[model samples]
Target: MGHSLKKSGLRQTRYGSGSFSSTYKFALLISLSRLAIEKGQDSCEGLALEYTDIAEKFIELYWKQAVPYTFNDEGQLILNQNNDKQAEIVNQIIKLRKIYSSLELLRRDSEEWLTLLKEVECTVKKMPVRYLQNINGQNFEFLYPLDQCGKQLILLPQVMYCLRQFSEIIEELCQKRWIDYIRKNSTNAPILNQLPNLEQFMFEPSRNQLNAVASVLVELQECKCFYCNKKMRKGSYAVDHFIPWSLYPSDTGHNFVLADSSCNSKKSNLLASDEFLQKWQERNEEQDLVIVDRISVLGFLTDKERSHKVAEWAYTHAKENNYQVWQG
Candidate 1:
């Protein structure tokens, strides 16, 4: 309902709910939709994803709730999740995820969560032919609750809303759970690992960009790092993708810049922390004739407008949720 990129019309889940909203039910489905798309290639048939490939993918979204902070005279914070505290936070997040996956939701008196998913499958089977696609392959097997990995999924017209809802549901659920766990008056002291970090999720690691391209950006920036205005040596600077490669994997020319190796490393895959949002946007907006010529020869600015749109879409979500962007 909030936002969607669905191709077909929305199909309401037959079973109603108070425990989970209709939007959330679709959110769950949407998360699955994303998983299927991420693992498979586009084809006339549809897209598919591995069943086991889910956990790692889910973890990326699972940690979206833990926001981090650094204290100075007032408090402390770091550019990335390099500290022991962050590690503990990640460990506990994984632990909770294991517990969560094990939960059967409505089947307290019966089987696992997959039982309910079976029922979900039954409901879906009755839907029209388009939504009732097949999922059978040697590489794919039913994951239960979810589906067989690499199973083709036919997304509805409101698909984007469904995927967007998955993130929203996750952030809300994680915060509420963590808050309840932390605020409860249990006899046991809160295990630091059990206590979720306040930092939201950061994107996963990506392959490094080409050095030839990195050097070109260095010259373009007058040797000043994009994140920090500091000078960077020719062979020392790292080329960073402004809108993380995880979020937007295509290697766009305008999306890259030379930065202090530390800054590039520290920024990791998180969006540029809010402070640098202006500079990042301004750099993207630079389209002078001379700059355009240089960018054309050294790198590719295939579609500046589209690139900016993708960045703004990512930043919009972060800004709305009060998630901190990375600043190294």
Candidate 2:
């Protein structure tokens, strides 16, 4: 299912819209732009993959820190320290603007570095605002739903009020990251606000983001392949996008499938259905095998061919997996 909005949801409110100081905004944009350029590579089309990289790094380096920690009954640190470390790194990053400027200038001439940075910038500029738009109308607090890979708009008025209060700190960090980067880089470099392609707060997740999603799935399934019923250690499997990213780039969490890499790649973008069932049956005598296909970005899914194919695949998969089929 697609993302939904709650009419009475007060969670969609923006915090302090006018609160970000010029310094913070500029610093934040710069940091994002720089990180994008440094960590991502350019695609065949010349656009940098930095947007993907930044998204990956953002989640990797900072996602945990952004989360709040609670203590246990024994007064031990019950929460993940990884998240705490991320927060610390972020704080350090806030301080790096002043300290790193001098060091950054000395290394500006490295062609390899410059090339990488440029690529990152190219990618970040193309990310869509759809992710960020989910926060509109509420306290301006939105989370990239870790489990769902989408966003959840808050609805409780109290939560909304608290989010507005919390945004002051988060927004400060966001702004600081931008300003610091600008100060460190040359004026000739791209200005973040001026980038026509810049998305608001939403970022197109990178492969790493998918990995994180995969990790969550593994945890959900106790580190086993959803299809093969095998133990999946690190590097033994991949999280499949039931709807391939190329075909349905906009989808986040729900469209994901945890499966063996070979099985996933075989089904890429091909509608799961009866024909697939026939082929799967032919390949394996097991009647319990369920087959899934990758979906397309174009055309109405309800169209005869697409719908039939999907239905066939889903039914077959259900039967094979011994799972109940809940029709949407």
Candidate 3:
């Protein structure tokens, strides 16, 4: 039998709950859902997630938002994450951003990186993790128990399955709510009136990082587009996500493919055909070592197994929903 899940409870906590003081709740939900996909299985068993691991996810989620958002060439301002003040995690990331240009650089400094993780873990355990399941004045306790989780937060039985099963919905809902919280914050009101693609700004990988990835992919693909196999001249190709970022937002090294500008644009936000999917899987299997050795240093997660698992999920989802497949 399939695992039983209370979709209503999840909805109530995320949507019907009272106003939020900070965006932590949304981040926590997104983190849990993504972790469920990455670490847990589609089973009815409970899953124990380390506090430090959760903290790492928190950093990745908040890192981009900590930077100043530029609007209309006037000036740049960091969006406030809390009603009263900037979120603590965001402030910490902002401080680190001054010292490091990319997450990969900061990660190389073991001392500073570990310190940030420790701090973030403490904040996460104290704040959102403590109060996420609380609806109104009562504790729902549907996701996890507050007191039972010591070193790690344990997802309740069937929670992991439900999270994985509904990952896309959970991700979209959290992102939308997170954006709404930022928009509603009084501090952000003035600057966000004409906000341009807040979702992309908040979630998408940095353009600089993609450019760096493009350079590596050029060598990997031998200046040939993965889709058309056509020779790509300098400055004529782009790094394309094998599984669309819109489908699965997280960047995994194995999911990237070098494609000419035409194929990249044509394949925008659509799953490539089955022929391409098979080719992508084969490429990852053959070049797993090279991808990990080279691309992981570029700051992308480079697990071939994990990337393939995500692709399996994405393609399965597309098939179920009859999503249009790009015929490249």
What CA RMSD would you report for each candidate? 15.4, 20.4, 2.7
List residue ranges in candidate 2 displaced over 4 A.
Answer: 1-204, 274-328
Instruction: Tell me each candidate's TM-score.
Output: 0.41, 0.26, 0.89
Worst 10 residues of 2 by lDDT: 293-302
Q: Candidates' lDDT values, in order? A: 0.44, 0.34, 0.85
Error of 1 at 37 (Å): 13
Task: Give the alpha carbon lDDT tens digit for every residue of 31-129 in model 3.
Answer: 888888778776789999998889988998888898988888888889999888889999999999999876767887999999999999999999998
Judging by TM-score, tell me the better candidate of 2 and 3. 3
Q: If the candidates were sorted by their TM-score against the true structure, best first, what order would they fall in? A: 3, 1, 2
Error of 2 at 215 (Å): 1.8
Better of 2 and 3 by lDDT: 3
Clashing pairs in 3: none
Q: Return the TM-score for candidate 3, rounded to 2 decimals.
A: 0.89
- lDDT by residue for model 2 over 1-328, one digit each (tens)? 0022222112221232232222222222223333322322222111222234443333223222222222232322211212113223334333433433321231243663344444433333322222232333333223222233232212222322222223223334444443333223333123332433212222234455567566656765577665555786687778765534432223323345576776666665543444433443342232111121111111001122332233343354346556432121
Per-residue C-alpha lDDT of model 1 across residues 144-255, encoded as one tens digit per residue: 2124322433333333334443443433443344333322323212333344443222322222325656656766788998877898776778877787765544444567
Query: Model 1 — which ten-residue stretch has the worst lDDT?
Result: 15-24
For residue 50, model 2's alpha carbon misses the true position, in angstroms, by: 32
Query: What C-alpha lDDT, on a 0 to 100 scale, does residue 135 get in candidate 3?
Result: 70
Best by TM-score: 3
